[model samples]
Target: MTPHDNLGYQRLFDDGLSFGVGFPLTNQNDTMPDVDEELRLARHAESVGFDALWARDVPTYWPSFGDAGQTFDVWPWLTQVATVTDELALGTASVVLPLRHPLHVAKAAATVDQLSGGRLVMGIASGDRDPEFPAFGVELSDRGTLFRESVELLRTVWREDYPEVESSWGTLDGEITLVPKPTTETVPLLPTGYARQTLEWIAEHGDGWLFYQLPQSTLESYLADWRDAAGDTPFSMAVQVELADDPGDGPEHIHQGFCAGTEWFRDYFSGLNEMGVDHVLVGLQSDDPEADLSRFADEVISPRS
Candidate 1:
């Protein structure tokens, strides 16, 4: 599989319009919940023409964090979710790369891809919460270095037959073959704000960017920087949304332009397209999950996307 084999990033940007949402892994209370229902919800999203679903890693549920993304462990959930669906792309909102050995990450990710028949996209972050870092014996300050090294090792093992990797994290010597060889050329590995790495580093090395919720103006600025740094490579972001029953009701900003109502949601996404946002992984754990999700699909996502 060559670079061309990866259809997810490209398809996302096609027709100049695309929409996808983040899977609500936890419940409204921000605790680990049964994922069976969430898995079905993901399948529902895919059936409704949604392009992708995201899985987030929550090592320790920090209620203070306010939002707890999909509760299941990232890689294991990816593999499990892959079995329940066939067409929709499966991805990680982000995996904390610095917390685990890159070899383990690579192996786990590759296994998911192989089992899923090459439909896995892994989003990696340097990590944010201070608690998670010490838990893994990784210093919070060194996350950037660890992130860069981890990515280098993952790519080397995946793309090269007998790979030799050198980095601050560790090294791989002699001929090594990372199995399952990503049915596609390479699995899409996106970078998050794991560290304060240069935009040039991300543009040149990462397949995409996993960013936080940002307003339209902010997103434009980010896209410009990314384009300058990355040239033609694609980028993605996660957004919070509150769907309303009223289609014409205006939006009310919750965090970063996340709002309710179909009209406002439509306009927001329209702005995203104009801003050159390739994909948006929305978190729909608002006051009303089913209503918001249904309204979004029927009114907003269905019409424009």
Candidate 2:
């Protein structure tokens, strides 16, 4: 398989518009809950036809950011989640690349990809929080450069054997080998929110893009630009949703998504599909995500599917 023969990519885009949910799938709030409950919800999502399970990389708890992506270290947590589910694609919604050693990211990602039967899609970002950069000994201003180098190094080591790589992160002289290559020729790398790079750079390097939620018009404009740059590579979005108890409830705006009925979401997703969105990472906002997830599948997913 070439770099493009990605199970996660195929799972996301093959069937047109697919839906995913962020973990800890148990709660949308900041507190991390029981792993056993998370696993149970993971199986529930798979059974209900959700296509993927997304994990967020929040290196530190910045109180200002609030949620902390539910505060789990993404790699081990994602691996645990991957173990129970048979077929759901596993992904990092966006890992902050500038804060990490590229070699570690490469090995960890490849291990997960191999373990999950090539279901890993790496969504990476440049460091965002100002505090996080200095905390990691990374300069905030240098993140764009660091992000580029890290992406280059990640692709290099994944695809090349004993690669002679030299970068700000470290150097590999073909003497030291990185073990456990990905299940594919290379695991899919999707840049999250540009990572401070140009669209052209992302298009050339990424398998796809994982973007933030946008209004339909804004999404149209961005999609137009993406099509011109990277034809047919998938473009995905992360959104928060509050699925209403009643199927017929009308639309109400939330932070980045909606608080509305299934009817509104169904049409909304249809519009998104028409405009070329590949996947939607749904962040269910209720305390009880399990119920909302199942309702979404029945009321929004199965009807269209």
Candidate 3:
């Protein structure tokens, strides 16, 4: 089977690679973007040849924690991004599974996946912001249980013949299958942060892994662990990048990304591909968005060295 059919995501897993940019809705500096501006940014990234545009579900803006992700409701933004872009893929950097029911996520994701003509990629996570969980009347401690149940339920609903599911959240009694099953052979589900699963469990179940930033040396070891866990699957991660014009500007470490020059950025990604990372989604607001996108496309993506 092709990578699209078996891996459950569009495009090849190996053979080449995929580069994408995350929407800069918020940052460590506490800068809030205008919604229209964010949309324009996404469009520009697509036009410049980034394969996918990712949005994070930030129900509450936590400036202290850093990064607001793309603005607007996550589901609606997925639909909006899908409508505006003709080729670029649409994705959720992740949706907090514990906050919304599995059924809602299943239906909405499938609808957007179908509507987007297989461009939608779903990233599921246990909730991150500590305070946000209690505010939603969900106990933060139960997120592990909630996440597993939700994942299982979503898969069941998507099956050709929906199977009965029993879980603490609820149960399926009748033949209530999720409609408009994903046009793609299988839906993509990425697990975020470490969650509660072991490496083996993640390897066996997740389509891809979404992890936080790591140092270059440490990143090698971390990805080694993931490759051991992944076997043959794809893995993705988010990086906080600040690409500069001068080739002399070197990398200075940040919380989850690095500040570096364009050449350094290109070299770093080339190394990442050699290390078995199928995709790398860079957050590019700190750089000159237009120039950075153009330079990266021409210097890095086009060559694919």
For lDDT, candidate 1 versus 2, the one ahead is 2
| Lowest summed lDDT window (length 10), candidate 3 | 1-10
> How accurate locally is residue 281 in candidate 2, as Cα lDDT from 0 to 100?
95
Tens-place lDDT digits, model 1, residues 1-305: 56436655545645665667776633443766657777777677777677777888777777777756766688888788787887767778688888888888878888888887777777888888787777778888888888888888888887778777778766668656777677766778888752568888888778877788876677788889888888767777777777666777787778654556788888878877777777887777565555556667777777775
User: Each candidate: how many clashes?
Assistant: 3, 0, 0
Return the lDDT, model 2, position 28.
45
Q: Where in model 2 is the C-alpha error above 4 Å?
A: none
Candidate 1, 10: how far from true, in Å? Answer: 4.1
Steric clash pairs (candidate 3):
none
Most lDDT-accurate candidate:
2
Candidate 2 lDDT = 0.87
Worst 10 residues of 1 by lDDT: 25-34
Tens-digit lDDT track for model 3 on 259-287?
88777877888888887777777877563
